[model samples]
Target: MGIFDWKHWVVILIVVVLVFGTKKLKGLGSDIGESIKGFRKAMNDEEKPAEATTPPAATPLNQPTTIDAQAQKVEEPARKD
Candidate 1:
């Protein structure tokens, strides 16, 4: 019998369905499709940063004028109850 015979296809399909149920096969197919879709999206996203965009401007760092900003620990006196 030829490999492309209808009986061969039917037997192979039946075996596959019995081994991995239809629900599982469907979920696996969708998962694989989603992964491939995400991969394509990520590849396309990288090209967006290649445009001639200016680097981010820096903001001035805050420097405290008073030594109080560099506070040292001071002990509190004990209060009588």
Candidate 2:
């Protein structure tokens, strides 16, 4: 028989269920199902184009501003021992 025969898989499945118990395995299966559903939803959403929306007008008092800055790394001079 091949390594991945149905009988071998069944034994492995039985051992896994015995080790982890059915309740935890059930919860794990549901969690996996939910994550997979969420992943598919995200993929479908990504495939759809986003609607263009205009930003609200900003008043001087409530307008947000950004500060631009640049950083440079300084190298220390090596001293001769």
Candidate 3:
């Protein structure tokens, strides 16, 4: 028989159940189920086309655009002698 025969799988299942207990196993099962459901939902959401959104208002051609930004000083690392 192959290594993954029915008897070997049954024994492995028994050992796993005995090691983890029923309550923890049940909670783990539900957590796995919820995560799988969430994954499927995210996949479905990704597959669907996004809704149309209004485009930003266009600026007047006569007005020049101004950009505001802050500059930060970066310290140089000390040279190792």
Output the number of the lDDT-best candidate.
Answer: 3
Candidate 3: segments with Cα more than 4 A from true spot = 52-81
Q: Report lDDT (CA) for all predictions.
A: 0.87, 0.92, 0.93
The TM-score obtained by model 3 is: 0.63
- Clash count, predicted structure 1: 0
Q: Give per-residue CA lDDT, model 1, range 1-65, as digits (tens).
A: 78779998999999999999999999999999999999999988877875567677665679544
lDDT per residue (tens digit) for residues 1-81 in model 2:
887999989999999999999999999999999999999999987887655445588669877888999989999999999
Better of 1 and 2 by TM-score: 2
Candidate structures ordered by lDDT, highest first:
3, 2, 1
Worst 10 residues of 2 by lDDT: 49-58
**TM-score-based ranking:** 3, 2, 1
lDDT of 2: 0.92
TM-score of each: 0.52, 0.62, 0.63
Global CA lDDT computed for model 3 = 0.93
Native-to-model Cα distance after best TM-score fit, residue 20 in candidate 3, in Å: 0.3
Tell me the spans in candidate 1 whose CA falls farther than 4 Å from its real position: 1-7, 52-54, 59-81
